[model samples]
Target: MIPSFPVDVERIDPLLASEVRRHYDRGGRTISFCSGSFLLATLGLLNQRTAITHWRYAEQFKQRFPHITYRDDSLYWYDGRIGCSAGSAAAIDLGIAVIRDDFGYEYANAVARRLVLPAHRDGGQSQFVQKPLAPVNAALAKVLDRAVKHSGSGSTVEQIAAKANMTRRTLDRHFIRHFNMTPHQWLCERKLEVARQLLETTHLSVEQIAGRAGFDNAVTLRHNFNKYLSVSPTKYRQTFKSSQQPF
Candidate 1:
């Protein structure tokens, strides 16, 4: 794992570069946090591979490594072999992903809970999210939890806001301030998380998963899965399930 470092380092020590290259050549996994991507790019490990660094360095990194596919919007990214976190906070999310991949969803979630962190955050989430000023009110939090619990019912943003006794505009403001996203986006993310958990832990069919996830249908689920994850639900299930370490 490569931690954040000065991206402006003019030259990598030859020995360190040689070691990193040797590790890659032997099919070792690689993970970089923040500007650590610079090291990976310098060695051409990121060429033609999707990568992300802190948004502050996006322009400079892209200019210097045009061959690397830089995803500015992603908070973190992983392609089985290589992984990257966009910033320090994102490093936690990526670390949890690594734990989930190595151990199992339940084990990872348990670990996250012990650390007082959210169990997961999708890798494709934007990097520009602002830190929330405070936690949501109890009513609003309860509504959000219920929405996730009954995601299959396809609750609309208006209905959810109403359940929390807030106007749509008010709810939007709260969501943006606390979650750095609109209510609809948060709802979609929650649904997607539910879908992913089911995929990882159950034998449910795609159509069934779609309904449970609050997607309009299986086709919509497939489309959203591909758009956000660059992988089909079936393929994602196979990848995670096959590689999942027994708890």
Candidate 2:
């Protein structure tokens, strides 16, 4: 069932919300798109559950429902019988996943082909979120652009700072203020994101993916994957693989 639009959670009828909660508690599956997660959350269905909403509203959702484990980076997320999608296009992705679960990969792929959408997408919000060049000074914007372009190149922080004609300290401050992360952290995240995409969509070996993702070797890639994602590269690939097809 679809929730009403303009998503004023406070206005949701208490009786209706209670009924929805009861339905889920009785083992009914629920799928929410974008701000519809608010309805499920208001019914207390999302407490301690991993879920996603439109990335633009992630912070607001978190503030309103602090108990939920909000996965801001996912296109969609599923925990047990509950599912959530980020924005409209991602709703289609979630639908395809449900189809695959009920039918099979072949049926889901057929539907995706008819819709002219990819059979599957890998990684997370990084693949869909457009990094806006905004609000920062021209120099900082240029530096950020360069960082995105060269994130998989194993570029040094000193080199990036030099490209911006800023001291390392100055670069660090700007990155912290603007990105809420250090340069090294941002670069590592970018590299790992790229590696995840490769793992899902390509037939590359772990060592090959590591080199392309700026890691020194497969060992380093595995170490960083475990540190950041709590899963080894091989395991991550296996978990997210779209079909039994090679790669």
Candidate 3:
């Protein structure tokens, strides 16, 4: 089901509310697929809860609900009461993972093979998001596109500010006004965004990811990761996302 998150919160209707109530009462897990993560999140049930969403929209998702820790690196994230999947394909992985957890590894393996994907992967939705961005700023907006394309190289705020040809203070203001974050914050988010990609797409170690993400070390990476994403660096990788979910 579609949720009004990153769109409108008041738009969630009575019918959907009733449905959610029923789901809650059923005593089963409540899981959101992709944008549907917005629903559980908006209901505030996901606050301080482990969850995930489509990696491409992770930045906007985090911006809209800072209370909820957005785990982009996970293939499928679940704290039992709530769950978030990475993207479309990760949904299948989530299904299998849940089945394995609920049923057994043998059955889960059967399901995974039936779906024709590897039984498991290293971690979160990170592999699925390649860090696509919409350039909306004026001067630095031109550089935003370049920034995302080379996100793997790790761009710094000072360096980016210079590229935008604006004073650091001006760039910081623009970042907040345009993207709802300071320039440094936005750059960190961007680095993490692509970090997920490398985690999933490449056989990189945490140290390598740290370097590519412009983080000083795994500890620093974990610090920033825990501050915003709310999940440990290792746990984020094994997470999942599913588009077939009904929310």
Model 1: per-residue lDDT, tens digit, 117-227? 886646432222233358889999999888878877788899988899999999999988888789988877777887888888888999999998899999988988887
TM-score per candidate, chains pooled: 0.70, 0.60, 0.50
lDDT of 2 by residue, 1-247 (tens): 4332344555778788777878888989888888888888877777877767887788888888888887754677764387788878888877877765554345667799889986553222212222232376788688778776876788778888898889999989888776666888878887886787688778899999999999889999998888766778898777665555521
Q: How many backbone clashes does candidate 1 have?
A: 0
Report the Cα RMSD per candidate.
4.4, 6.5, 11.1
**Deviation in Å, model 2, residue 186 alpha carbon:** 0.9
Winning model by lDDT: 1
**Model 2 residue 22 lDDT?**
82
lDDT of each: 0.81, 0.73, 0.66
Ranking by lDDT: 1, 2, 3
Instruction: Give the alpha carbon lDDT tens digit for every residue of 126-228 in model 3.
Output: 2222223455667677788888788767678888889999888988877766665677777777778666655544567878898888788888888877776
Over the full model, what C-alpha lDDT does candidate 1 score relative to the true structure? 0.81
